[model samples]
Target chain A: MKPTARWIPYFLVAPAFAIFTLAILGPIIATFGLSLTDWDGFSTPSFIGLENFVRAFNDKVYTSSYGHAAIYIVATLVLEVLVGLILAGLVSAKRNTTFYRVAFFTPVMLPLVVISVLWSFLLNPDLGILNRILDQVGLESWKHIWLGDQSTALLSISVISGWIFAGFYMAIFYAGFQRIPSTIIESARLDGASELQLLRQIKIPMIKNLTEVAVLLCVTGGIQVFDLVYVLTNGGPYDTTQVPTTYLVRVVFRDQQMGYGSALAVILTLVVVGFGLIYNKLRTKDDSVVEY
Target chain B: MFKGKRLIAGMAVGLLGLAVLTGCSKGDSADKVLRIATPSLGDSELPVWEAAKASYEAAHEGWTVEFIQQDDDLYSTVGLPTLLNGKNSPDAYFEWAGARLDQRVAEGFAADISTDIESSGLKDLFNDGAFAGYDSGGKLSMIPRARDVTNVLWYNVDMFAKNGVTPPKTWDELNTVCAKFKSLKINCFVQGNKDLWTVGNWGGHIISRVAGEALYAETLQKKKPMNGPEFIKGLTVLSDLAKNGYVNESVNSIADNEAASLFFQGKAAFHPIGSWLVGTQQDQAPDFKMDFINLPAITDGAGDQDSIMAVFTGYIVNAKSSKKTEVLDFFKELYSPENAKKIADSGTVLLVKSLAGGTLDPLTAKINALLDGAKVVVAPPDTGFELPVADALNAAQAEVIGGKSTPQAALDAAQEKVAALK
Candidate 1:
């Protein structure tokens, strides 16, 4: 090869590398540098060493925000991923499932802010339709302040997250199920396998890789949940629903504690990276690719 | 190989040229433009802003005035700061006249507009008290526009008349009225604490009344512990209201707009909020007749019984802007007596003394009267003090109201947070 050929690959990759450095890598490094200083986004940043990290450790609300995020992640794993798997299986089994598919995926098409605002109205204890319906059905005793109570606020947000994204996971699983050969299903039916048995034994097992991907997506996405919680509860009813992102935003913008907020951001980044690593380690290495 | 090196060097030179050109384009027309940043105004208020923009531009040949409007909550917190730090920062921006303005001044975002105000004849337009808190150690940093009574007990006039209840004058009378409303299956008061500031403002006033404004200031400014007996006593009032079901059960879930809707819909007897509710009521529920009273006096309280929770709001010229004279000129036209009357006619209570003479809407007049009657004026925690300290107290108030924590325990937690801030 000519000397120019060796530089061709570098030339081709230069733009992308430069963009990545400017956009993603630069901000990460800047945030880490910021984490070490006592800056308020305006004044000269005084080097505070690791004081912010120590403050984070001792900050009860900041530490509790991680706990809320953990709950949200666990809740979304079952609510989004598992529920999505069942929905995909059911939709795959039936003929002319277009209506169900569209209805399920409709929320995924709308913005999360719009969805959150809509659900906030629906869950409103006084004027919302949810409480009104309960009253109408003579279930007044069952009506509770869904987003106000500490016991229910975070879970309500998690369920709303599930509601918005379950369809997304379902679409992925449905696509995976469609790729399975019809002959295998035909043989199973001929062997007297019930529809439930076919779904539980064959279809679900076949979509294992898709389910794993969905679970991973849900876990990472759950850890960074912000807009939905922000619009709905705003980490309120006494910070019961405060996740790391919401807390980070409050500290950085509302409280104007840029250094502490940057520290929180760094900690959140580490957490998300740690979770990704753990998920990778625990995931089964089933190298057997399904043939078409 | 020589050709390849030439090609690489040419590309590098081209990229450098493009970067310089791009940078030049940003400032090409920047000198002739004046940008104003403010919270998104209502449709009725937009015309006033547009008129000001037109007037300012018409006065200066080859000049343009730009407005960057953002949502109110976002504007105060993240939006204005982001804009100030951006490539094309505003020449002037709207801000509350307390800790937030102090912050902007400290961060070098606010200009010393005292000379501009005096030279432009804008100083003589308003009452002497209008510019009360717009300065720091005699260096005026902002042009005062509106004197807002931030928290008032706004009640439906018709609801009060029909229910055979008069506006309460004391804490016991307030409780009796709430009890009467409760017996009739009505929420005596409705507040939305989702954003925390709604209750934060109201609770701040109550704290001022019970604990005295000095201690309230001390606690929120981190000079004293928040878990003091007076602070606990003040929070107990809020907790009792929530526990007795005087306020809506969904106070912590719903937004302030939703709570106002409930009051408008006659689902609640009273709504405690800022003076801006008059404009909101006019826009959202045009036919809803509402009147407000200062918070009822607390018996045996340490603070002035006639204290009012309020804040002045206005615009500050950007300290870093080269267009300070132009911004002041624009304000001269925007806040002229004639324009001030137009704003007052639009249901806003202006700080202009001339416009305060029997020109305001009845509800706004009542609010002005309440402000006039106040013996002590206490600023809300969120606007009057450091945000982290305000947030701690607000969260503690929410905890007590939500039945999540006792007033003592909640205040203890808040004290801990405040101490951590130091």
Candidate 2:
């Protein structure tokens, strides 16, 4: 390529960069700027530097909501990655992986709000099919007020969110599994390696990059989850299901505390982006040492 | 910080300049359309608006009426402000007549129609309390279309008869009724407390019943501390209801609309909700023999037994719009007894004192009588207070109900939080 052609590459990317500047970076910078001012959507924004952040640290609801987000992110990550990998491995082991893959991926295709609402009815303590089935199976004691009880509400919502996105991770892992050389797996099997041993030693190690991608997607998605929780619990039953987004919405729109909510948004972005950068840095260093 | 302010100011000026340029390019129309936005309830209100629009357009020449219907959530969160920003703003909009309207008025969105409403002899047409929310500093920003009684408990007659439980007249009697329903594996009162507003409404009724509307309002306005003895005791009644499982076990899981659905499905014997439920019940369960009753007075309580929690829900004109004359003409036609009759026929309870007398169904007539006997009406906490304070009160109520905090502790926490709100 000519030296001027390299300039053409930058020129070609300018529109995308401008769009990003206007759409993403602008809002993020505006939010950070607004975090220092007490604006209620209307009226002049009065600068209240560090007050919103200071209040956020002292505010029990704010702190607890972030804790809930952490819980939701961790729970969703474990369920999605672990279950997704298992389902991917099981489906790939079979000759007819197409049907299984399609079936697993169906939930991801459905709207998150619709699935959440559907799960709400299914998990309802009264007249829900879940409780009815439990009654018929003589496990009536196991029936719970799934989205109402403080102890179970966050976990139950996480389970639903994880269930919806599991298929996406599953598809990624299945593709990862497909990329594994058949000879390596065959040799492992010939060496008397069990299916579990083959999966742990060969398949998983070969899919490290795909696994990393899956983890990153799951973590970011889980951290920013709003619609399912909003549709189902709405940060209720004593705000037990409150994540940052739900509480931020309450602060911004409902409560009209725009500055405080902006602070929350900024903090959430930092947490998510910070985690991504750290993970990338560590992974990049490890890959450099691999000397492939 | 100064740079940031200047940048934002520059952006605002640029936007305003752009809007002015656009306005000049479009030019003004001789026959202007008076665009009115209303939230769609999928009920009789839409038809009423249509009828009003037609009637108004017929009377006024060289003018048009446009009804922009929005979903309730969008109307509040985005539509209201977007419509009010002096760019293609609707001449008028329907909004809940309370703190929401108050907020709009404070933000200079709601026009004060006090003189127009009164001089036109229209103010006399509505009930005194109909203007309670919109009236401030001798100005009426909005007029109510209907008086919503939100705290009354309605019982299914068939369920009550089958269970051999009569409507309770006191707190102890209510407990007995709940126990009877429990024995029959039926929920006593169906509640969707997850929304927090529902819990707040229930708490409002109990608080009004115990501490009276005067004290409740005072406490809410911060004229009196919310952590007072009366307030704590009133909240205890609500805590008892949740802790004792008088409400549905999954009360905190379901949405308010879903809880009402469960009530209509005969899953619960008693449903405590606003008068709006009557319209929904008529639509959803036409044959369900339901009768409305007041929340039983607490024994030795200071509040009047006849008093109920009632508030107005209605429309406000956009102060920023240039179509005030056209909007008033529409309101005049809309508030006429003829349209009021249509609204009443649609199963809504009207609070227009002049149009109060109507040929209504047996159930509605019964509810109207119950409303008439009310000595003093109280606003629901959610509608009465600012959103942040209301939200704080709701969270506190949830804590008390969920057994996470004692009633006193919750109230104390709420008092502190609300006091801190600007």
Candidate 3:
């Protein structure tokens, strides 16, 4: 390569590194220094060593909130990828699919805060239209406590989450399906094979990389779902709906426990990195089986 | 020498600003100017900022009164805590009792005003037992809102009379009335426990009924274990109400105001709420005829069957304030019978000595009279825990009502957290 061409790459990368250091690395470094101290954002920070972490580990609210985040991520991610892949296959099989595109891709565009506020009213016990529908169906007994009871609160929030984002996953899968040549699918279908036989034998083997990408996105997004949960639940009804992000805000801002809250943020980052490692390992094992 | 030089610099800048400050700082004040900061819970008396600026101007003819009001404005949204940590904060901020006050006192975020109170003549006026209820370092950290308010069980007089149900006096009687109302398909009690404090109110106030003022105060304010008989009895009363399905089903996120809407709609026959609701109702639900009744005593209660659990809001001037003397004088004027009457007339049962007649809401009057007659008044039992402990207990209430944990388990969990506050 010419000397100037090599320098072009460095010039191109400088802005990106500047942004990364200022935005991401700056906060991480500040938070690390904070985690080692006892600062309530006012008094001079004293070296407290690991006291904040000690308290966080024992704090029931923190533990309960992370548990909610785990359940929220696992349930939503699995459902989105599986349901999304199927819808994508159905759409991509048809020629020139504008209708399918519109039908499956609009809901994800709506803002999450708007969805949370809308659902709060929709699930209200007395004023809500949901119970009214139950009454109409002669299922008054099944009208059920919706947001109030501990049993249904987590699942209810998950359903709203799934309903909002499934469309985006479907669009992702549909794009991945389009990238594969039609001949592979046609060649398999012409062999007098059943639809399921075609799906399992050819389609699945062809789009494994796209499936990995979809799973990765779903895992990352599911793990970080905050705005909807924050507005709707605020980690209440006895912390059954508690999520880590909500608790972090309460500690750092409302309780003024900046050092302790920073410790929680660092731990949460490790959890997301752990999920990424598991996904990468599974993907590597799947990729080892190369087609001849 | 270095410290003296900086002090001289500070004096130079402070002197450079006397013209601006002579706005709120009166001539007679010892020296300092005062700034007041408050999270504005809407007051019709002053549309928050306008009222604050106007009143500060009126009272502080010479010195400046910087009124930093947090409305729905984003400035307050982001600035409240950061500004609190600045070299100086508001000389006085309007304060309401409970964690809002307790948390500040515990964090060493507030200035001690015991000396100012002793000198103000207002101390003797306030020389009642209110200050003795809860003390921090043997000093009254707050000058409390004038009257004691319990969560009153308010019912529609017309509805109770027509239904042939006398209001309930005991936990069993409450259950019976609730059952009768269920037969007629009416919600007997209204609450919103989804957010936790609603459940805290369930034990904090109703527990006062079951345990009586003395024992409830002993356990809640005195740091006595909740496992004892009085605390156990109080939890049992709340758990029974929850078990019977007597509580309004809409409570999770249906805020307190929404519950009031239920009574206005006549969907619920009674609401267990603070006495101040009468003030809120006159403006929010004028057509509804509301009446108050005490929580029926558990037999062999503290002093009288009529006593109610109550909390008070209070005010204090900054001891470090340069205008400390002026702020004290302004407060002394602010709490006079006439001005305090405005507070009472506006809504609260004024803490200043008894105000003129019409200013008192009938329900407010009765609760005040009831307190006057009582041999003992209980602070809600759970608040006696130190700051973090009280908060943890308040937070754990959600689990108790959800049946995720037993009352003692919940209280114990709260107690453990309280003990950990150190």
Candidate 3 - chain A - TM: 0.87
Model 3, chain B only, scores a TM-score of 0.76
Tens-place lDDT per residue, model 3, B1-422, is 66865786688689768856875564434534567665554575444335445565676676665666676332222354565666667777655455445655666656677787778666655535657543456666776655555566889887899999898777568778889998888888887655455566656666666666566555555357665666666676677676777777666656666677777778888888777677778888887887877776666544456666666556645444556566666566556665666666666655554463444666677877776666655555333333343456566555655556777787777677655543
User: What would the per-residue lDDT of candidate 1 be over residues B34-59, giving only the tens digit for each residue?
Assistant: 99999987676778878988988888
* Model 2 root-mean-square deviation: 5.5
Q: Which regions of candidate 2 deviate over 4 angstroms? A: A1-22, A285-292, B1-22, B26-31, B41-43, B118-133, B349-354
The full ranking of all candidates by lDDT, starting with the best, is 1, 2, 3
Q: Which one wins on lDDT?
A: 1
Which stretches of candidate 1 lie above 4 Å from their native place? A5-12, A287-292, B1-30
TM-score of 1: 0.94
What is the Cα-based lDDT of residue B16 in candidate 3?
Answer: 68
DockQ category of candidate 3: acceptable
**Ranked candidates, highest DockQ first:** 1, 2, 3
Candidate closer to the true structure by TM-score (higher is better), 1 or 2: 1
Model 2 clash pairs are: B150-B274
**Listed models, DockQ each:** 0.69, 0.60, 0.26
**Candidate 2, TM-score vs. the true structure?**
0.90
lDDT of all predictions, in order shown?
0.88, 0.80, 0.68
